[model samples]
Target: MTEANSTPSVSLKLLVLVAILVVFAVVIVLLIFFLCLRGSRSWKRRKLAVKHSSGSIPLVSKEIMVVKTSDLTPATTSEIGDVEGDPKKEADVKVDIGAVTAGKSEVSGGGAHRSEVSVEDPNIGWGRWYSMSEVELATRGFAEGNVIGEGGYGVVYRGILQDGSVVAVKNLLNNKGQAEKEFKVEVEAIGKVRHKNLVRLVGYCAEGARRMLVYEYVDNGNLEQWLHGDVGPVSPLTWDIRMRIATGTAKGLAYLHEGLEPKVVHRDIKSSNILLDKNWNAKVSDFGLAKLLGSEKTHVTTRVMGTFGYVAPEYASSGMLNERSDVYSFGVLLMEIITGRSPIDYSRPPGEMNLVDWFKAMVASRRSEELVDPLIEIPPSPRSLKRVLLICLRCIDLDVVKRPKMGQIVHMLETDDFPFRSELRTVREKDPVSSHADVSIKVPYPPPKHAETVEKSRWR
Candidate 1:
């Protein structure tokens, strides 16, 4: 009786152990099922949220905001030494897309078009989304004749909207992955950026795999055409006009660098990117590769991307980028403006192949006047030309830390006083009789004392 009872007890224990194991397994399976269901619901909710946010402008992400420097009521001078230069202390420029005409005359506030939207509107945000069909109709079925410009991003076509307004539509390349990325980047960078000098983004189209961006139509061609096109032996851009273009370009860049809260770094700052309207006002265009930088971050380690010959050495080598990189490119652009030469020309003799090297050589040899574009109708005065050249050199300094902020650049460009005016005065104090003897000391624009002697001795 005892043996039989013990065997039964052992069997019962085994059975209990099996039952416990089975129960644990079932519990695990149910838990997994519950987790999967919760995850699925979360994913669906996210998708729906994106869909709902599509038609209307979505709130700006933390990484980027549609905030301008003027909105913050910045101090007169940046704590980091970036100076804001406005001769009249005018209010921020406001642009109206609806009233924009391709070749309109300047309105009251120096803008080509009148502004309908107030800068203070909180509702103001990125542009609207257009159906693919609407874009197709606007471009007239993407006719070859409608193509106004072509770039690495895609082809730019001139489209006439139903409202009788003209627009430049960029049909992004069909590389599915890259096209989408660029579309998002451009929309974020350009949308809601309100500056007279910036090409305003009218709208965009993202249907299926296709991507398109519409910009305000600029009637006059880009700065590249004015500088290098087949205009004739004598270019129509007078010294005053060139200065105006330069100053405007500087102001636009200053706005981007210092005027915005999280500043915009225009990775590319070449002549081709500077668009001009009928009034010859310089509007900085092409933000396809632009990057936004918050005040907290000193730099971003990004894949080096920009036009060759304009890339800053520090950025190109290490892929570390900041506002200084834009300054470097702007310096190269200034060289192009002053010399009327491409940044890199393979056809030229080896010594002159690179514009930067050639320019440095010219400056070192005191042949600055020789490097001027012969086409310029009226030559800039010795002092004025020298000031611009010095600024350019300062911008391109290999020691990136030494480059001036864009606002400082604007102030230097617009101010008639030479940067080294004190040094010249000191020399004059030491040698009172020969104060004007040094031809290099004179500033630009209005000729200095002993102008005839300086003109005959140095400028010629």
Candidate 2:
């Protein structure tokens, strides 16, 4: 009887243990279900926040927003005007800064947004975007007669907008390597910056494989045509006009070098890249080849790409580019302007084939007057001419360190007083073995005694 009672007790203990385990499992399942439900609710709330924060403007993906396409449609303009007039419409259109800021912070890991959308300006809505059909209609289907200019990059056509506004449209060549990057660079470089000297980017069109840039129409032709075209010799540029062009070009370059936040180096500073307005004001154009320099970085290393005649020697050889390289090219341009000669001409005598070399030889021999263009009827003041020549020599110094900065060049050009003294020193060419090779020279410039006086007097 006692054995039977002990067996019942063991069975009772086993039953109680099983019941406790079942209750624990049910509790765990309920807890898991509650957690999942909470997570779902939180996700829905965040989704609603994003939805409510974005107004009429579609929430473009990060990639599209970064590109900043300046395409203004007729409908978009009308919508913008309506928003401006109606307070409620304006409020609806306005972005919820708090939500956007929070979302961006989460998406970017608390880092700044790389592709932040700029607040739309009421005066100028976002840039106008043109459809491919509209561009074709404006350019007459890219007809041959409509083409105004052509370069390695692509062809430029004169287009008339519906409002009778004239624009120059650049159609980038489809097959060229890095054409898209070049397009983006041009748009980014010139889109934000506005100056009388820099070319204005009105709008752009990127439809399918077609990439085009629209710019304000400059009435007068380029400096290259005026300086070297068939009409150059017959109707020579006057002394005053030449000076004005030089001064204006210098100011533009100085602005590019110093005025912008991150300075820009115009890799190709040649006569062909400089355009003239109706008033004959020089405006720098063709920023497709421009390079940006950060505040800390002094130079960039890349494959040298520029016109052969206008490229700086150091840059052409080693592919090291900086503002000084641009200065060297500008020196060559100044030489061309003075001599009315091409940078390189096969027709010229072998000794004078290269304008820079010939100019150097003349300056080394103290016969710079002979280098002046014969087409110039009324010669510039002798002192002024000599000063300009010296400035050019300093700009093209063999040692890059010796080259004057663009700002200094501008001051030297504008002031009557000479601020620096030039000393010419001859050095052998890179090839020490070749006696027949032309010897490279260095022109060092030391500040003159009267530099301070000139600066003070100009200010006074």
Candidate 3:
């Protein structure tokens, strides 16, 4: 009887120990479940907040291809090197970049999923700033081989984000005075302005001592290269393509002048600043010298800063920066597109050094055949030629008041005598140039009551 009692007591002890173990295990499991739920909630909240503030290019069922010039390309989402910066600018990304579109591109990153989007400053377009470490990785340690180009502002390197987003990082060297102000102003202004004819700013990284802007990588580069270079044309931008670019650029400028709340002036307008997309749609970039208009209805006073050759004659001679200043620069660009000549070539005789004067003199002298590009001796049509020349003249008007508003210029470009024929090619043989149609476009409203009555009577 004693042995049986002892055995029951030992069994009871074992049961108690087992119960305690089970309770401890249950507590641990519950803790883990709650922690996971909390972490997941935090992640979801961040994503939702970021998405609402910053809209991204929603994924569509479209295949992205890298427009390869040569087959060599970068690996997908390759690890970029580390960046030393304030904790905030550092990033650990895993994004899929889309295919390469630029002509000079050999490689591109797979497009990124929505998670790759930046949570800060959702307003920044195609450009974002990468920490020194991240950029180093994108450029493979800022290797000399990766440096694509440079300018007065800074150097540009081709980089691939972990998410496979291909971007061009403009590493600015000097951010002092106007240069620094321009950097910030451009970021603030262009970030808010979204239009097809404007280049997209992906994101930007402003790390310690390092400032950079990110832009959608343009493969073909600037227009000056393909149009005037000795290299046999790699891409033949058709006449229609040219017209579309002209129209698009004009629209962008018009947006700057009249579209804004108080209006802005693009002090500089030149061919080099015009960037083209895959479709040859021209985008106006580089508003480093742009001036914003205040409530003052008339032109404001300021120092002049623009490309010498493309600056408005009046603004260049006397710092009179205004909307008309931009109009004048547009004229110079228009002439270049028509004649493919440098704005001021000292090599030309004294009279010919000035492109506007040379071309206008030729046109007025009825030497129309001489102004046509040699490559297109027999251009597709004469109407196209005359219209271009006339528009160029109106743009270069000596008086600011005489210049056609961008809206009016766009109208003439859209006029019905489009896609000209061979016969319409006849040069302006009539003594009076029919360009008055373009000038008359500036009239804001219908003729006065008396004038309207006179017209009705004449019709009768």
RMSD, every candidate, angstroms: 17.5, 16.7, 16.5
- Candidate 3 lDDT tens digits, 1-460: 9999999999999999999999999999999999999999999999887544343222211122332223312221111222111243322111112121122223236521111111234223334434444566677766777786766667778888767888777777654533344455455446457777776666654433345566777666666654576745333655666678788889998887878745667776777778877778788877656666644656755555666567766665555567887888888888787667777678989878877668766765666556765543335356676677767776877667878898888877878564333322342344233332232122122111211111111010
- Write the residue-wise lDDT of candidate 2 on 121-140 in tens digits: 32232245565556776898
Identify the runs in model 2 with alpha carbons over 4 angstroms from their true place.
Answer: 1-126, 420-460
Candidate 1 on 1-460: residue-level lDDT in tens?
9999999999999999999999999999999999999999999999877544443234322111122222321111001111112253311112112111112222356222211111222333566555444566789878999998987778999998777889999988866455655665666567778898889998765444566788999999899999989999898877778778888888899998888867788888889999999888999998867777778878877766788778887877767888999998998899898888998799999879878778876776678799888999789998888888887777887778878899898888988875475755674687564312233623222211221111111100
TM-score for each model: 0.67, 0.67, 0.63
Model 1: per-residue Cα lDDT at residue 392: 78
After TM-score superposition, what is the CA distance of residue 292 in candidate 1 from its true location, in Å? 1.0
Q: Model 3 residue 391 lDDT?
A: 77
Question: Model 1: runs farther than 4 Å from truth?
Answer: 1-124, 423-460
Q: Residue 48: error of model 3 in Å?
A: 14
Clashes of each: 5, 5, 33
List candidate 3 stretches off by more than 4 Å. 1-129, 175-178, 233-235, 418-460
For candidate 2, the 10 contiguous residues with the lowest summed lDDT are 451-460
In model 1, the clashing pairs are 69-259, 383-443, 383-444, 384-443, 384-444
lDDT of each: 0.70, 0.66, 0.59
Q: After superposition, how far is residue 123 of candidate 2 from its true place, in Å?
A: 7.9
